[model samples]
Target: MAVTSEPVLAIDVGGTRMKGSVVDAAGRELHGCTRPTPRADGPDAVVEAVVAFAADLTARAGGVAAAGIVVPGIVDEDSGTAVLSANLGWRDLPMRSVLEARLGVPLAFGQDVRAGGLAEVRLGAARGARDALFVPIGTGIGAAVVLDGRPVSGSGFAGEIGHLVVDAGGAACGCGLRGCLETVASAPAVARRYAARTGRATPVPEIAAAAGRGDDPAAVAVWAEAVDALAGVFATCATLLGPEIVVVGGGLAESGALLLDPLRAALDGRLSFQRRPRVVRAALGDRAGALGAGLMARERLQAGVGSAR
Candidate 1:
């Protein structure tokens, strides 16, 4: 059946919150809602919450034809299983099957960062680029690599760029590594490091402003360290993958050039015989995940791949 005219449900399941939206085939949202993720209550509780939230949205949308969901961690989209989400505390959960049974519809599932990358490529900053890197820096950092205009999953474990070690002897990471990029480069890490040095808790934006203005030595040092760490990663990426553009998103990317300009400069300072990628801020912002989910659902419908009944 050609159900392209019907609306579809899209959900982006984050560690701390779940965002849902219903969109028509043209990708314009018809309805949307956000709910707190009860992660502290356990993984099963989080799954149940997703089901309930999705159900409510479906009903509110007057019954969507299908649902598209994206989440963090290791996700095997081929099998529709959430391989592992340390934040959500799940391993090998058959999420798509469960959701199909509960929601009574076929759906599409994907990793959140990859989904965000897709949205940016199709509709946002990375549009018209054949190869790009999409990295969203928030509570943690993750990358989505687009090669030949398609996001590569590497069998569900590809884009763990946050775990890449930058300071091998520095802070311990939750993933049992020392001095991973996320520990020093993420938004929270920047603020935490600033507080530890200055005895004052300051956000990334303020720290960035202070660094740019050269007013605070602590802020300058902390921000410079983060930008340097990220530059090293991007330099390595430029050498290995040679992406034409790198789209930086999430809360930290909101700093705009305060982040990208320094990052581009630091990356250039490191690269001598490598392809330099243009570092740009993501155009979709936080809604990229949900919009990507909607795109996935519409693609599923267009391809005649119905969700498991």
Candidate 2:
């Protein structure tokens, strides 16, 4: 019997860290590691780091055929370049070719949220939903709109839900917009705004805990605002996309029902004329992005072999 080999090396690049693993045919991560990104080193240095990360996984896998990299930004998949990434200081960079030659394997790349959404829609939360939205709320909020178990990357920028203006005259955002959803709803926003109000150096987990105890007014208010902002975004997406479910992931989802219960109720309350889909948390842990990257690699491998004939 001929021994078959592993398919691909998956790499996920975030604003602060890098993660990688080798995935088998069954969507299992065979080897994995997480490391902080030396982001200040510019795009060239980042490319080298990505190449090295994928190579390490390939070596550990004993052997792998190809690689996939998921990045946070407006990635022009057709150009195989990162159109721009505000967090990473990237611009029109040819990342795939650089990593391809460096790792000596065929490379597949995609926008991080889109890739993660694909994984969830196909293998995780919204598996059978005809239409779904995968939203990850952390320092920022973004989503992948899944249509028929596949992600729809509109203008390569469709899932930028965080930029939605939930408060027309509220707080200013890094994107130079006022009252953007991220300013009020993201985990960092929840923590920073709470700290600003209470003069306490509390983290997000502590803030959620304080809210639970009913001992912190600022925590409760901030948490509610975050939930409300999220509700606004969900309402808009539901009205527009009509997905069967909204799969929530990222650090904010860690709040469990604290985030979900209110968000679902708020969304449900707002829907007077349209059907409301259930808002649910993603089943995967922090490794969701890396797992999605692995699936992208596997998808690319399948596509390659299919086209070879």
Task: Find the candidate with the highest lDDT and give its number.
Answer: 1
Please write out the lDDT profile of model 2 over residues 111-196, one tens digit for every residue.
88988887787778887787999999988899988887777766466788999999999889989999999999888888889989
Ten-residue stretch with the least lDDT total in model 1: 300-309
Question: How do the residues 1-309 of candidate 1 rate in per-residue lDDT, one tens digit apiece?
Answer: 458889999999998989999999778999998999999999999989999999899889988988899999998877788999887888999888888788888888888998999899998999999999999999999999999987888778988999999998999998998999999999999999999999998878999999999999999999999999999999889999999999999899988888888899999999987888999999999999998888888777776665321
Best by TM-score: 1
Task: Return the TM-score for each candidate structure.
Answer: 0.95, 0.92
Those runs of model 2 whose alpha carbons end farther than 4 Å from true positions after fitting are: 1-5, 213-215, 305-309
Q: lDDT (CA) for every model shown?
A: 0.90, 0.80
Candidate 1 lDDT at 229 equals 96
